[model samples]
Structure formats: C-alpha cells, structure tokens
Target: MNEQPRNPDPEIGDAFYGFVASEPQLTWHDGTPRLYFKAGQEHYEYGPDGSRTKLPTTFHDVVAFRGAAVSGDETLSKLDWFVAHGRLEPNTNPNTGVETKEFIANRLGPDAARMNIEIGTPRRRSQMESPNRRQPARQVVFEPPEQDQPEHEQPTRAM
Candidate 1:
C-alpha cells in the first residue's frame, strides 16, 4: 500500500478545540465556545500615553471557551457545530443543540475537516452510551522461528 512519509516537523499541533451538545441549559442556541492555543502569542493593550502594554505571552485563540457561574463545566459545546463539508451549521434538534459539552478536539490543518482530541472525550450520557466498566490489560506477543531451521541453530537471532 502507498502512504505519505511522515513529516518530522515538530511545529505541527492541533489548532481548534471544543465539542457538541444535545440539550444545553443556556438560552442562546449558538453558545458553544471553541478554544485554541498557540505558542509565543501575547495580548496587547494601549495605555494612555501612547505606550503599548504587551502583557505576558501565552498561547491564545479566538475560539477557546471560558467557564461561567464560577464553577461549572470548563468544556464548551457551542462551537461544536454539526460540521459537514467543513462549514458551520444552524441550530436544530438532534443535529445541533446546546446541551452538555460532548468532545473537544484540535483541527488537523487548513482543511478544518479533520480533528484530533483526547481519547475518550467524556460525555454525561446515560449507561446506554457508556458500557465498558474496566479497561482491558495490556499484553505483548512473540513469534517463534520457522520449522525449516537447521538442527544446530544456536538461538532465535540470525547471524
């Protein structure tokens, strides 16, 4: 099978974040807050005497979500549009609604179609949604030498 060789560029990283919702408790429909982080970026503010104040630097994004009510869910669901054909979708039932946050992932590239998020993005769905109780144990396997080997074979390693 043909495959593109993996690029060794270490700068590549996820650019977008957030997830979808089923039934949100907020009044607004498009309330999802997508979050993103970049390196070496800073916030600039203009002071009174024509001086600019470049505060500390940290990864910032235009879609990153913030928590409300002091102590609630940190994940944002408003930005999780039912993305099809790489476009933002309108609010609707089953397809789109502000329920609880679902998943938060980062964009793969300029395509904005592919996303990668933390594995098992947790959801508050009932038992029917989540079934696995305990994770399975990890295991490794080893293969033996072929049967047609020489009788005087010393070991598994070939000289």
Candidate 2:
C-alpha cells in the first residue's frame, strides 16, 4: 500500500484564472520553444460578516513550452481571459541576486466561445504581411473530448 504525503507544498497544483495582460512573446530559449506572458487576476476578500471587498488585480508571469506554448499563443491574444493550471517556480536573478517567481503553465488556453473570439482565415505570408487584408468571418469553438464515447464520437480538441 502507498501512503500519501502528510504535508504537501501549498503552491503545487495551483490553478490561475485571469486575463492575458500582455502579448505572449515567443522565443527560443536554449533550443527550446518558449512563450512568456503576463496574466492579471482580480482579487477579492471576504470578511467574517459575509461581506466581500474587491482588491487590486494581481499579475503573474507565465511560461509555457513547446506545443502548449505555440497553441496557447496562437489561439490567445492580449486581454483574453484564460484558465491555467500548473506549478509555481521560484528562481533567482543571477545578475541581480533577486528572487523571482513564475507560473509554469502545464495546461493553458482561452475559451473562444466565452471570449467571443473570431478566427481569421488562413492567409499566405505575403497576405499576412499586407496591411490591406480583409477580415474573415470564421470562428473557433472548443469541445471537450468524449473519452467514454466511441472513438468515432470523440471530438478532436487540437487547435
């Protein structure tokens, strides 16, 4: 029999609900594709009397890797609401000797239907570079995979 650990790290397996406060910057770090973004979540406090007070929005530095990073950045835009689940990582700035924290997004994405996001038509590189392009009337919808159903009935969730 396996026994669960009595005390676990509180920050592990944390979930964050917020809007992408900044554009996701994609870059190659040590030959690995990485996407970095800032997300902001509004804070609220509940008192003993059951009254809730709104507080300032707290910003989080988020990092995603490889496919998750690419898909997330491609599908999500700045100010788009998103829900992310991951572990918290703390690091120290080698140059400044200051400690910094970031959330490594294991799973992250935006809900197109809830966010009212319009999917633009695919365009060639030249067309994408041109400023006179017309907007497309396409949209994207997300459906969860039906694992319990037959293989034919399962919906693909790839973006």
Candidate 3:
C-alpha cells in the first residue's frame, strides 16, 4: 500500500478558551459516542491607560467524539471554563440549506488559567492484591522522560 510521509509541522487546528454556555449533551451517532456543547468565547480590548473593555461573547457549537466524548461528558458542565482545540467545519442544514460552522474538537480540557488544579499521586496496585468488586478505570497521566543532566548541574523547580 502506498502511503504519504507525515508532515513534521502539520496543521492541527485552532484553539479557543471560553466558558461553557450550555449543558453538555452526550449522544450516540451511528454507534459512535458524541458529545455536544456550546462555548461562549469572550473578547477584550485594552486601552492605552491599561483599562480593558469587554466585548460580547461569541457562542460556538463544539463537538467531541469517542474517548473525548466520554471524558467531556463526565467533566464538563454549564458555566465551566474550558479550552478546546479543533477545526471548524461547515455544517449545512438539509431543510434550510443554511451553512453553519461547527467546531470539531480533537482535544478538550479545563482551562488552567481560570482555575487551580492539583496533580494527584498515581495509585499503584500490588501484584498480590485482588479486587473484590470491579473498579472504574483510572485516568492515566503522561510524564515526560527525565533528561540526563550534567554532573555539575542540578534540576531546579519553578516557584
């Protein structure tokens, strides 16, 4: 089979940070799970005197599929601040033939800028321990591999 080489700097999608404008709905489309929500994105203009003027919030329709749909349904709610990275696709209404854009999110998460978050220590399971009841799957956290540092240099933490 012929395949094309992957682009090193491929275009992913645009990112938007906003508050949830409506309650998220989880539905199934053609046997695939889908999550739908509206995001209210606010804009601001800064004046020369450092004063900021708030602009009207723009509402956008956002959708996520598969694993993202399940996670979003569990964590997202109305009025919650979130960040979504996705591409806009034209969605036309069959009855009206009106074209509208929908944000198809590949990634969705809480906006850290507007909230505080704590990274919990990962729970480890013992080889001998057996669970009496079925446990919910734990969310996996990815940690980058530690890079080798010079003997004279020590790692520092940012405050």
Candidate 4:
C-alpha cells in the first residue's frame, strides 16, 4: 500500500462584515493602487434568555489591492456597511519592530443589509454599441424540467 503525504502548511482565509469607520485612502505602490480604510465591527452578547446586548465596536485596518482598491475607493463611503473576504497578514514597523495584523481583502462589496441589488442578464454586443441602450428584459419565471423530478416525492429532497 502506498501512502499519500500531506502538506504541512495550508492557506487560511476569513471574511467579516462591518461598517466603514473612516474615509478610504487610495495610494500607489509599484504602479499598483492600494486602498486603505478602517472598519467598525459590531460585537454582541446573548444572554440565557436570548436577549442581545451590543458591545463596543472593534476597529480593524483593511487594505484592498489593484482593481478591488479602485472599486472600493469609488463605492465605499464612511459609515457604509460592507463585507470583505480575505486573509490576515502581518505588518512589522521598521522603526519599532512591532507587528500588527491587517486584513488584506481579495474581494469586497456592499453588505445587502444596507443596500439593494438587482441581478441582470449580460448585455449583447449590440446593446454595448449605444450608451443609451434600453435595459434588457428581466427573467420573471423559472420552471425546472420534469425529467429531473424523482419518481417518488421525498419529504426532504435536496434541490
């Protein structure tokens, strides 16, 4: 029997939802844009009776790179609720040798809790020809094919 070796190091990532605590600042590094901001993460405590209590919000430093940085700079404003998915990286100060963790976002976007979003179909090439082109028709109904239905209706079937 042959045994497969497992890798020792693995990548870890995290995501958090919070409100912007400060205005985003855009900077350039080696021709790449970087967006930096602070996020206020709310904390809550639940009692035995299911009562929820709000705690002091914790502030975190967040950075987005390149295209994500550009979009974040344009779309994010102070106090706006947003979500970020990324990994925590360590940054060490050259003068003090002190290290701190910063959230480096691979993806970031507005949180649905405070924003409305619509899903639309991709526009055809003709639609791109004009800046004033009318919006495409939206999908209103969905019908699954009958062939995909199981012979017997299970009470807890996965869709």
The number of the candidate with the highest TM-score is 3
Q: Compare candidates 1 and 2 on lDDT and give the better one.
A: 2
Q: Which segments of candidate 4 are over 4 A away from where they belong?
A: 1-12, 94-97, 116-159
Q: Residue-wise lDDT of candidate 4 within 12-127, one digit each (tens)?
A: 57997998999999999999999999999999999999999999999989999988898788677778789888988998868999888889998877776675432232222233
- Which portions of model 2 show Cα errors greater than 4 Å? 1-12, 47-51, 112-114, 118-159
Model 2 lDDT per residue over 3-115, tens place: 98899876658887888999989998888889899999899999999999999989889999988788777777788788887878996768999888988987877754456
Q: lDDT of each prediction vs. the true structure?
A: 0.34, 0.79, 0.79, 0.81
Task: Show model 1 residue runs off by greater than 4 Å.
Answer: 1-26, 29-116, 123-136, 150-159
| Model 1 C-alpha lDDT versus the unseen true structure | 0.34
Which candidate gets the maximum lDDT versus the true structure? Answer: 4
- Per-residue lDDT of candidate 3, residues 1-159 (tens digit): 988788667766798788889999999989999999888999999999999999988998899998878877766678878888888899986899988899888887766567443223112122224666678889999999999878896779899
lDDT for each residue of candidate 1 in 1-159, tens digit (9 for 90 to 100): 988769766544333322332323332237654333221334679988999988765432122233331111222233232221121223233656643322222221111233332324432223123457576887888898767857695867778
lDDT of 1 at 118: 32
Native RMSD of candidate 3 (Å): 12.9
Error of 2 at 4 (Å): 21
lDDT over C-alpha atoms for residue 114 of model 4: 70
TM-scores, all candidates, are 0.20, 0.60, 0.65, 0.63
Q: After superposition, how far is residue 8 of candidate 4 from its true place, in Å?
A: 19
Q: What is the C-alpha RMSD of each candidate to the true structure, in Å?
A: 15.6, 16.1, 12.9, 11.2
